[model samples]
Target: MGALSDVRVVDLTQVLAGPYCTMLLADMGADVVKVERPGGDLIRSSPPHLDDPEAEPYGGYFQSVNRGKRSIELDLGADDDRETFLELVETADVVVENYRVGTMESFDLAYETLAERNPELIYASIRGFGDPRTGETDRQGQPSFDIIAQALGGVMEITGAEDGPPMKVGPGIGDLFTATLNCIGILGALHHRERTGEGQYVDTAMYDSMLSMTERAIYLQSYQGSPPTRCGNAHPTLFPYNAFAVADGYVVVSAFGTNHWRALCDGIDRPDLADAYPRPADRLEHREEIHAELTEWMATHTTDDVVDRLEGSVPVAPVQDTDAIFGDPHVHEREMLYEVDQPGAGETVDIAGSAIKMSKTNPKPRGRAPLLDEHREELLAELAAQHEAISEK
Candidate 1:
């Protein structure tokens, strides 16, 4: 059993942000009931399918985020299906969704209605701008995705090269970060409910999350009256703290401190540079010159050679790709990758494991993502039995 083994969640979410939130909850042992529309999640048709052509509906994109959850098909447009969803909600501890601003209200299944049916229901929503209950935005009804969030929230502005156009981060931090924050909000609401026997609506916006992620820029803009701009791989406040090109690929080196700078200079056989620039301010003043010298020195050595020379004294690492990560001993030692049986492909596939480690209540994926309506009959029977028991009382 995991930490949240007793909790049940009605997951009415699709795509990355909402499903990723419930994925974490499910990893922590919440009984996540994924309520999908008849056509199923759009990501199910996304690319990178397994070898088998006859496999089930979903591909890797869907499988990665929707794992270890029970799936039930429900069309809220239909009266009976809507009633069934409400019944499931009545028995659930939490209900989460990532629909448009007023979609739930249109279906007459908003948090207000769900909370009325189950007073202690923790209703959570993930939106692009956020729910009005928190703070209404001018863009409340406007649709958004990860790229939009990144561009509008100051993240793209401060990323990439100083000379290039604003760039979005490689991964969808906009969606993933919002999902993580929403999960935290849900956990906090759950704690409050445990104490007071009352639940509340919780939400996080992708744009808001991106703004929070770029907090340093916000403060700089406020204090210095200047917006932060991209500085390429170098940090705004630190020098000799950027990626350097080696013989084979690149390696990031950070010799920001005085001792580290001296060590780096000694390692690269440039003791004169260390003597000339002792302080960080001095180094920053001559950033271009020092960077050039370092670059020249680094180009002379391979990544492995540089690592061997500076591993203990300087913070340095080769820029690695997924293949390198897969073979890294540290990854295996930390249990960051898991191999799970995929029923559709009839083979085991590797998926990322949980980062949140615990001594006793270790959280993990319970199983693979469920087939469409796979648990519908079992769930209906369980709900019927629950209703009958309540009626008997």
Candidate 2:
């Protein structure tokens, strides 16, 4: 069994961050019961769906993060459904939600209410800003998404070509990072509960997570008295740590360290470079010259040629697209990709596997994402059985 096999989580989240957080817990064998509204999660109807009639009702967006969780429909606005959720909370170790600051209060199911019902319940929230209980802000209850967080978090400020407009990152780092932190918070709270037999609120804000992630930029600005700006793929503090275009494609080189720089010079058959720019600061001062020299040399070789020449000597990697990642032997051997049979689809699809590897109790997705309210009957029966057993006791 997984480490968290005995833990139960009531997942009252939709879309990305919250669901992804609970998915991490579920992967570790938490019994995550997703409490959906009457119509189900907004992402259930998201795009990139299969053409087959027998395919899973939802699309890739929903399937990717919601895997290994049980789903049950509940209209929290209704008194009966609210009471049902309370009953579920009393039996759960954790309850996670990502909604506006006051949304839960509207249903009279806020953390305060749930904590009263079950004093040992771990309640976590993933909000755009943060809940008022932990910290208050004027931006509380303001709607936000990945892009908004990216822009506000200073990520966009330092993310593009030096002279170009600010750009959003390729992936949803705003949501994903916040989710990971929130999961960490939940785990910490769980540990605290284990020690004290008490549960407390755990809160994570996307904006806050973004600010935390851009720590390097913050420190640079403070130390230099100048805010760092975008310089394409180059790092501000290191030289020869940028992507360059080869004949076939792009390859990133990270030969900023003294030994690695020497190795790079040797790999390129240019011992003079190491002698002329002995120190990393010297190389940084002559960044344009170094970039141009590398660019000229790179144009003569293919990505493979560059990688082959510098593979073991210097930190180098050819920029790989998703297709390359899918076919990579190292990726397969590491089990970074997982294939699961879609619930209703006759075909199997690949999803990203967990990165948390363990010697014992290795965590993995228990199964496919559930169909809407698919486990309603089974879950309600379980709850009813628990209630009956408690009454008997």
Model 2 weakest 10-residue run by lDDT: 339-348
Residue-level lDDT tens digits of model 2 in 92-209: 9999999999999998888889999999999999999988998788999999999999999999999999999999999999999999999999999999999999999999999999
Model 2 ranges off by over 4 Å: none
Candidate-wise lDDT, in order: 0.93, 0.93
lDDT string, candidate 1, 1-393, tens digits: 899999999999999999999999999999999999998877888877787876875777888899999999999999999999999999899999999899999999989999999999999999999999999878998898999999999999999999999999998899999999999999999999999999999989999999999999999999999888999999988988999999999999999999999999998888999999999999999999999999999998999999999999999999999999999999999888877777756787878889999999998877788888889999999999999999999
> What does candidate 1 score on TM?
0.98
* Residue 245 local lDDT, model 1: 90
Off by over 4 Å in 1: none
